[model samples]
Target: MRALTAAAIGLAAALALVLAMTAVGAPSGETSPEPLLTTVPKHP
Candidate 1:
């Protein structure tokens, strides 16, 4: 039972770290453009 609890805690910590990194790398409510999707077949 103790082992299971420790594993759960570790998993939660890892998940939190990943989420924090993602949030910092790409902030919320921000729009990112895709040049490849935008260009092509334009004024052709």
Candidate 2:
């Protein structure tokens, strides 16, 4: 159906926009911090 196709296209476009924004805002090179998970103490 045309409606379903349109919805899928809109969703894809929104997702791409979000990804682009995230990429643009993200830190690059040496300034990036180590991932938080690595800093957490592991349980025995």
CA deviation > 4 Å runs, candidate 2: 26-44
- Residues 1-44 of candidate 2 have per-residue lDDT tens digits of 99999999999999999999998896666854755565668789
Residues 2-39, model 1: lDDT tens digits: 99999999999999999999888965585668545665
User: How far off is model 1, as Cα RMSD?
Assistant: 6.5
Residue pairs that clash (backbone atoms under 3 angstroms), model 2: none
Off by over 4 Å in 1: 26-44
Model 2's lDDT to the true fold? 0.88
Instruction: List the lowest-lDDT window of 10 residues for candidate 1.
Output: 30-39
